[model samples]
Target: MITRSERTLNYAVLVLFSVIALFPVLLILSTALSPDEIGAGGSALSLEFGNFAEAWEQGNFGSYMRTSVIVAVSVVTLATLFSVMAGYAFGTMQFRGSEVIFYLILLGIMVPAEALVVALYFDLRSVGLTNTLVAIVMPQVAQSVAFGTFWMRAYFRSSSREVVEAARLDGAGHWRTLWRVLVPMGRPAITTMIVLMFMWTWNEFLIPLVMATDESLRTAPLGLAFFQGQYTAGTSLLAAGAVLVALPVVVVYLFLQRHFIRGMVEGVAK
Candidate 1:
């Protein structure tokens, strides 16, 4: 059905965007591999692979990575669980004040984090949670849950009524139906949410920056910022640190990309 000209045009557009997306990544890799001893005026084509090791050692990435992993996993796990339950309740179950409560929760998604961050920092400080992993994890969990609830609620609402009826007729409890019936079928959507939440939590900066004063509690991005500030002249090392911080996110996306794409497509079609 497509003409040759249209096909060529599509290919051209795809190739153009592909380069646009990859150019920065290639530049970073080139810079990271360049000799760390060279000044900023040096070309970025050297093969000094030891830049990553030097950056890792100098940046104290081990602690930063550990903190990031813990915060991200905790946030995603708690957020996903809470979002699924709230989403199912809002999407399927009818009750008094359901709409009001759901809207209240939805406001969490609508509100910008930047707007509430100062107040949130004060609240956490009042509770003596500052400079702790809990400070970083809790706020992100709330934010992720807000969006997750919205996403899962849409999925549950659009799911087959026949399946719900069958589960009910079999006398399955709400929890049973959710876990045994709906969840298995919702793997794509759930995985998509997990991948998204992980990326967001891993890359989060503002919360950690404001909440964590301890050098050991800094997340990867925050640590990278500090590393850049301290090592302004170490261009190759800075690039390597950037790559190290970003690598986990890339790995996670690659692993869940199929499910993430399928979920997004399905959500759109619905």
Candidate 2:
């Protein structure tokens, strides 16, 4: 049904946007591989693979990467579990004040994290959690859970009621139905949520900057900032560090892109 002109126009737009998005990434890769420091003209193309090794050692990225992985994994795991449960209840079960409670939780998605971060910092400090991984992980977990619950609730609400009835008829209780029936069928949505949460938690900067004063506890992005500040003259190293920090996210997305896209499309349609 589509005209040739329309198809061409769509391809043109996609190519344009793709270039816009990829230009910076290509520049970074170029800079990272250049032997000389990047300048206004950007780094010259070369095959300096040693830049990554140098950046890794100089930036102390190993510890930062380890910390980031731990925090991201912990936050995503806890947030997904909690969000699935809360979303199921809100989507399927009726109880007193349930709407009110769900609305209150939804307030979290409405509010910006920047607005609450200052107060959250003070609250964590009061509890002696500042300068700790727990401080960063906890806030991000809460934030991720807010969005995850909202996302999963929509999925659950749109799920087939006949399936739930069948599960009940098979003597499956609510817990068993959720874990055995719903969860298995919800792989696309669940994987999408996990990927989203992982990216957010991995890329988080402000909370870690505010909460983590100890060098050992800094996340990869925070460490990259410090590395940038210290190695302003080492352009290749800086670009390499940036790539290293971003690699995990890129790798994860590539692996789960199919499920991620499917989940997003289905969620939107529902």
Give TM per candidate. 0.87, 0.87
> What shift in Å separates residue 154 of candidate 2 from its native position after superposition?
1.3
The digit string of per-residue lDDT tens for model 1 on 112-229 reads 7798789988988898988888888888899888888888998899888899789989999889999989989888788888887887789888999999999899999999998888
The runs of at least 3 residues in candidate 2 whose Cα sits more than 4 Å from the true structure, single-residue gaps closed, are 1-13, 36-47, 258-270
| Candidate 2 structure quality by residue, lDDT tens digits, 1-270 | 999999999999999999999999999988887774343333343247677776778668878898998999899999999999999999998999988888777777767779878999998889898998788898898988888888889879988899999999999999999999998998878888888888888999999999999999999999999888887644888888889999999998789887667655643411
- Give the worst 10-residue stretch by lDDT in candidate 1: 38-47
TM-score of 1: 0.87
Which candidate ranks first by lDDT, i.e. highest?
A: 2
**Clash pairs (backbone) in predicted model 2:** none
